[model samples]
Target chain A: MLSRPDFHALIKENRVHSSLYYDERVFQEELENIWYKTWVYVGHVSEVPKKNDYVTKAIGPTPILMVHDRHGNISLLQNKCPHRGNQLCAYQKGNRTSFTCPYHAWTFANSGELVGLAFPDGYEGVDKSEFSLGKVPRIAIYRGLVFGSFAKEGPSLEEHLGDAKRALDQMLDNSPEGELELTAGFLQHRTKANWKFVLENETDGYHPGSVHGSIFQVASSPVPALYKPESLALTRDYGNGHTEFDLRPQWRHVGKPMYWFNTTAEKLPLYTEAMKKAYGEQRSQEIMIDGSPHIMIFPNLFIAEIQMFVIQPVSVNETIQHVTALQFKGAPDFNRRLRQQTMGSVGPAGFLLADDTEMYERNHRGALINNPEWIVLTRGEKRETRDEDGHRIGHSTDEVTQRGIWRHYLKLMTEQA
Target chain B: MIDENEIDPSIAEPVALSPEQELMLRRIEQFLYYEARLQDLHAYDAWESLWTDDAIYWIPANGENPDPETQMSYVYDNRSRIGVRIKQLKTGKRHTQTPRSQLARIISNIEFIAQNGDEFEVRANAFIYEDSLRGETTWAARNEYRLRLVDNKLKLVRKKVVLVNNNKPIYTLSFLV
Candidate 1:
């Protein structure tokens, strides 16, 4: 029997034990207590735009598929064939009228209705409803992103999203049509690091200067400026393990819009015109200045400004990231720029991201070393404070987000125990 | 950003050519070898100089079916972006390339696929073996290049790298493919 360590002690106010990155038992418990029990993001609704469109993904080790059925409903279906344990749909993404298991030829409608099976004479007494594909107990959609939970009950998606909903709101409002198209394919990156490294790195605003100074030096980036102490950009702890690098203050400092893109409205005249036409001139300007989010939703999803990331955990020391360009519908010109920028700044070969990945691998290696056994995270805790909405806000280059994430994580790991 | 309707020089079928055309191919073959050498040596400046002003260096994601305008690509650098890539490499601060990965590449099967006046299309095979602190990573790709003769010297206008495992998860593409 594995002994349990107090997660509260492991996760302190200003530091976290390095063992969290290497403990297999802890990783398994995380999958059971959090990933399986709580709502896990599966895929975006934009990914399954039409009926019969389906994409396969995994929640922890269990394979699941997201499908848009004939009834214009989006739902989650277990990818396992009820007859035996063969994988039902193997392809990454495709249009499928029905899922037919290759081993036993068990055919099911796209809506998880088991239509028939090969050699049915032997199974004439079996009930089709009982043999149909299993589904996640709960499926929720919030602002086009799909989430599935295996547990029968917990917080609703709206309640789980909580303050984090603002991030998605800002992201969607960037588009004049107030809709997004994630048709741009995924760029998957394999990492030899713990899944927690990805979550920690998402809002660790301090590392950009040290880790990504090279790329920023060459390009006229607004990121370096935001890290300055005097800069108005704030790092926020949105509670529930969600965190953000809120650059809105610096973006709005000029009292004008389009600073996030570092371009004038004149440059993207067509997009600007559409924005004004859709949401009126004043609202359009505010939306442009507010820009998109650089936020990490608890456990897996990240709305990293120009791109979106879905972090998938494999083991204690292995993880994979699915990255895609954030596309705005009815804004071809802006989408074109965003697509080109995403190619340069993300993925495995990305100028900024490659260096960060280096840190991820190195961080894992460092954690393995027998040391003080703790990773010091005492960056800006002294200056951190809460806002009117109860969000813990700190300097852009602060560790308040880290502390907040650990706080929420401690609550989940202990309460559910 | 490729046009599906038009005949792409890089992917065209190879045909038997005249002896005179073979001589022209020999010169282009030499340029390919020279280009490969610079990449292996991490010669950023010299390698960058091989491009024309209106050049494109692209690496298509998902095996080249969908165009870059529709589906995302690994790299879709147009002239200036290519310059930024090289500039970042030279900055001595790219942690991914700080202790740059030692690379050795082999280019083979030079196919003279198409010709259009001063422009020529060539297809070749490349296997790049990289030895880094992390471990060894081998990258294999089909190199499709569109070369233009500027002042009687071959200059790269476009180079498309189509990796075999584009559809699958890739470990590290921090270095040149």
Candidate 2:
């Protein structure tokens, strides 16, 4: 166990030791105090569309089964069969009215209720009512996304979201029907780095120009009129460790040095015309020509205003990110296709994203050597902080957002449970 | 020029052709082969040029339809979008592309589906293997090609790829499959 003094010192300094990434002790602490205690995003409500549909996932090593009951309420339950401690659901996802454990034929309702048990003669002396499936203490939903917390007491989901709710609203507001549906599949990728490293990259704005320079060069070379930088806005310090970077108009232009997406007038017309047909001229123009922001909900969820990326920490040094593209509940098919194309650039197998994964691996490899002291989070220090919708804004290249995340991280890590 | 009426009917029914039809098909095939070769060689720019000024590249997410307007696709690209992807691939700072995506494509099973005046539709199959820093990834799909012939030259109207496993979880699709 780490001494309280050591923890306080680390927090007061506003930085964490490199060991936090690889130390089993710190990993365990994070599992208990952070992941299990906070409302961690499990999956979108669209994942379990039908009654009795269930999917399995891991929240900091704890296997959980998310099921939609007959009444359509989604519940998170421990994947264990209360009888003899056997795992109940074996598959990744499937539709079944009831789950019968292969070990003992102990049957459970889709709602996690113990419905049947075999060999009544062997259990005559025991009470079957006491062996109900253990439910995740708290399960909540914010804008169609489901989250589960093991701790029975803590902040409410909205309270925990704090100022980050705006980012969530950004995603929900984009849908014409005021609802977003998680597209059919996901892009899953595993990385050899501390999960925090992967999670932090989602909101880090400083790396784009430098790290993706080649991409910018190619995108800008033939179509210099496409790429622009001024239109991008990087916002840091939404309370509770959340940060967001809005890269829209400026980043959409074709030939400027920056991230992916060609922001050319020629290309805009194609999307604009399609959008106008689907959503009417004004609304279609707004949805297509104007780019969306990427939101990083502190600790784990990376909601890209239009898409969703969930980062799951597998081990002290392993992480898995699940990328899901979302469609407006009733948007035109062409718009969905356009969204999918943009999403593909960021998906696990995307040109831009695959490069990011390699960078993470390289960073992890570099961090493992000879005890590197610190990974720099100091960029755009001279820029003034502007307030926008309850967020602190900086230049597109600013690292202040990353600093904000580390600050909240230190606070969470130092607090006593 | 080879007469459309003289062509074999077993492969596909013969349709009326202007004097430029045979030349157009040859040019279109050349463009298709060249694009496939570029992707196989990881030359994104050369591959991107097979499209017309207003063309679309699609990989359907589900269903048998090749339309990009109404269905979700693995990849949906216009010229600008494809340009951005090429830039991303060429960027040295791209962590995922550090080792670069090495690819090989086996394209076959070509057949003409439809044609009207300058616009035509062709179908084919593609098996692509892409390797990067992570590992090797494989994709196989039936493709639908919509081309417009102008002045005896072929330009892409749409290239729709239907992956055998479009609904399954995919790692990433950085390059054209």
Candidate 3:
């Protein structure tokens, strides 16, 4: 085990030790301190909308089942059966009143109650209450998105989210009904890179033009204003490792019709008309101009360009990225456009994302070099400003957001185990 | 969602090919063989030019799904997106392509699934062997091509690649499958 001082030495304000990415000891420390303790996005309530609907997902190393109970409450249960530690839920998703373990025929209710056991007479003195599938320590939901924390106590999900709530609201408020769904299935990509690489790259503004230059050059549509830093988009560190690439305040006053940002009145006639009717013209205009803020919800969640990316660390150098393109429940045309836009940039073969995967692997390889002790995180330190919400806002071309992430990471990683 | 009306009526079902159609099959097999060669050689421009102006190159995620608008896909590109992708590959700045993929593929089981006026739906299976800095990836796929003969030259209107492991978590699909 690394001492607290050793953990503290691994991170600094302008640079972090490369061992943070390559060291198995550091990786194990993260799994225990960060992954198990923090609030991690497990699944959305929309996934299991009705009674008995369930899906098996992983929050770090623990496999869990997110199921809607008979009372319509969503519960997170360890997918492992209490009997003999067998995996209980084998399928990815299904509707079932009870799950029967294939190995021991131990039956668990949708609510995670141990209702049946093979040869109960042989284990007459066993307490059924003690053998129920273990429940996750806590679960929190915001705007239909569910998050699970393995720690018995910590800050509430709301506190952890901080000013990142605005981005979630934007995602939900884009729909007239103020709801979004994951009707569109996920695009899963397993890459040979550290989980932190995905977290940093998602909010990194310095790489778009260089890393995704080919995509930018080839897009027939007008480039997204966020990609053009001259437009003055801000990368804000909301603390708690949550940060957002804010497009709203920058483009709020751009007073011209821009098609990519959806400000043009004639660009999407049917969808625009629907939005206007549902949200009124003024609010519709705001939603359009604000565009969608690229958000990193610390540790695991990422909402960028209309897709939700959940980073799952498989090993020291392996990460599985699950991306779900969201849909507006009431707006089919708008949802279709969102899906198209998201598909263009994310997923396994996305023109923009495929390049990023390559970069992550290469970056991981480079971090393995023992000579380079530190990876630079300094970019726009001098230009930092505090927004009204007390979040640190930096230039779009800066690495301020990464610094924010490491601050919380260093704090969490160094805490007494 | 793909407009069902926009889809060629012939691909709606399988049909028998006539003698002349059978001859066209021989040419298609040759076309597919060289198309694979162009990709293996990293001749992106030549490979891209093989497509018609209104082409749809798709690799659906989570099994075969007809609706690209609502369903996720590995690669769902229109002609413009395809152009941008090829442009990126050509820039030689895409770091992932550095020491570009050493790829070779075997195309087999070519058959005419259906035919309509001036259009044909062809299906084939392939085993693509790829090697890069990361490691080797063996990709086996069911390749479905929507072709049109323009001025006696075959033009690709669509290429739908269905990988055997379509629903699983995949590594970087930087190269064409």
TM-score of chain A of each: 0.98, 0.86, 0.95
Residue-wise lDDT of candidate 1 within A284-322, one digit each (tens)?
Answer: 999998889999999899998889999898888988888
Best prediction by DockQ: 1
User: What docking grade does candidate 1 earn?
Assistant: acceptable
Worst 10 residues of 2 chain B by lDDT: B1-10
Residues A1-417, candidate 3, lDDT per residue (tens digit)? 554338677788989999889788888888888888889999888888879888778888677889998667899999888879988776777777888999989898888888998888998788888888898889999989899998899899999888788789987777778887888878888899898999999889888878877666655444445556675788989899998788665666665423434447576677778778898988887777676658999889898857889899989999989997877777787777778777877877787788899889988998999886899988988888888878899888789899999999988987764
Candidate numbers, best TM-score first, in rank order: 1, 3, 2
Tens digits of per-residue lDDT, candidate 2, B54-103, equal: 88877666344534554345567777776676666665555665566788
DockQ, candidate 3, vs. native dimer: 0.44
lDDT of each: 0.86, 0.68, 0.82
Q: Which candidate would rank higher by DockQ, 1 or 3?
A: 1
- For candidate 1, the chain B TM-score comes to 0.90
TM-score of each: 0.96, 0.72, 0.92
Model 2, runs deviating above 4 Å: A1-16, A218-232, A246-292, A382-392, B1-95, B101-177
Give one digit per residue, the lDDT tens place, for model 3 in B1-177.
122123343444556778998898999999999899988898888999999999999998876555676788888889987887888788777767877989999999888887888898899999999999889988999999999999998989999998878777888888866
Model 2 chain A: ten consecutive residues of lowest lDDT: A219-228
- The CAPRI classification for model 2 reads as incorrect
